[model samples]
Target: MLFFVALLVDGILAGSVYALVALAFVVVYRVSRVINFSLGEWVTFAARLVGTGTHALALPLAGALAFASAGMAALALAFNHVVLHRLIGHPPISLVMVTIGFGAVLQASTVLFFPAGSGAISLPVPSEPIEIGGLFLVPGKLVAAAIAGLGVLIVARVYRTRTGLALRAIADDPQAAMASGIDIDRHVVLTWSMAGVIAVVAGTLSAAVWGGGLSLVLVGLKVFPIVVVGGMDSVAGTVVGALLIGVLESEAAGYLNPVLGAGFSSLAPYLVLLGVLLVRPYGLFGTPGIERI
Candidate 1:
């Protein structure tokens, strides 16, 4: 029971970082219906920017994270205004391809420019662990989880606001929303902007947790299952999905890793994703779309 409890907490901590990543996906998807396949690149980019701040600008970790967050948000907004806007009328497939190309370009740019991030990154946090009710927790992970929880809370609260409803309106049907004078373009920009900020939070916390590098971009791929399981369009479902995957992944790593050989834990999330798809095509919380045709 104690072991189970510990694993549960660990999973929650890990899932917290993933939740932010999934939220980044959900935010943009809600308004644009575009997957932003390259979204993970921004996570890697932001993590790299932190290294830039610490080395070039001599900023501390907190300052570096702050700088990276602002920079990423600005970059996302600019990308929306310049690139996405230009491709507004293109086919969805074309947009997805563009995102794939953009990801490649961003990856290349990151390698050429942010050399510090080519390899694994290590963030220094206190070595001491926090013990509660016979369970020990890492301080860094606890902090990251707290921050992630707050981000989730804020997002949930936002849905109740006027602007948030307008954003949802765009998500329901961009064309109809536009006809209703909801200013689809502005909402799209806002969603992307939020995604950028969410990326930084996810990336930075991930670095502080396991580490950071170009590999962190795989975190993007990992989010597919999360959003699918949690309901790609449902914020509350995202939280539940992250928690479920986190717990399962952690448990697999701890128990199955030794029995099934190493790396089995890594495959756990995808297995859950497959199961979810089989059981509920629309996801545990995702809304079912009605086809006019």
Candidate 2:
């Protein structure tokens, strides 16, 4: 029915957005084992930078996007090298708290320097929505989703290559990986770099769909549920989780509106996330690793 179709579209869009952000979280966690509470701020930062460059500075869209991405990448590198690297070997809880504190500092700084209040900003990408059989699909969302999917493939391929294998080994055991001649510091830095790129991708797509500025800041938190549903360690699970959550949420909003109160649909992903965590704490594809007696 038409109702079902609408729901499907909404869910896909939501899921795609979550998946892209979640990809960054999973990547960072795999490499550093640090849960970045500020991941969403990076998306917001990139979006605002691109938006401000294009709208305020009058740069071309391509130039704006590129400059914003580069700036974010640089910041990511700085965080890894200057901040996080020094905190290694600290207590896990202490390290996590530090990152959370780091995120707060970044958020405050963003407000002070940028001073751009939250509102939607248009993306630099094309604006024409796609239509199929009379239903309109947001072209920006579709394009972003496609790009994220392609990125997963490319990233996977990289994981199989020598450098990527080394990264994985480092993730599995830092001391052993270093003993085997893998550069742990470099791998960690590289992981942050890769995550920065993905965050830029997510930020770009988000600005296209939802505009830019402070509105995009919370995208990092939005990724939590997606990564939770998708096994944190499984790339394929991320893709699957995105699609499922996206479509389901969309459809729920459309069809269940009459039965449930307004805004109920928006809660679908979190509900699913909670349910999954309570039921399968390791996540859908996450393994239950054990220690020897």
List clash counts for every candidate, in order.
0, 9
Which one is best on lDDT? 1
RMSD of 1: 2.1
Output the lDDT of residue 188, model 1. 81
lDDT of 1: 0.83
Cα lDDT tens digits for candidate 2, 1-293: 87677667767766767787788877778878888888878887777777677777878777876777788878889988888888877888877787787778777777877746432455445677677887887766777777766777787788899998897787778889989988877787788888887777788777677666666765567677777777777677787877787786677777675689777777777889999989987678766567799
Clashing pairs in 1: none
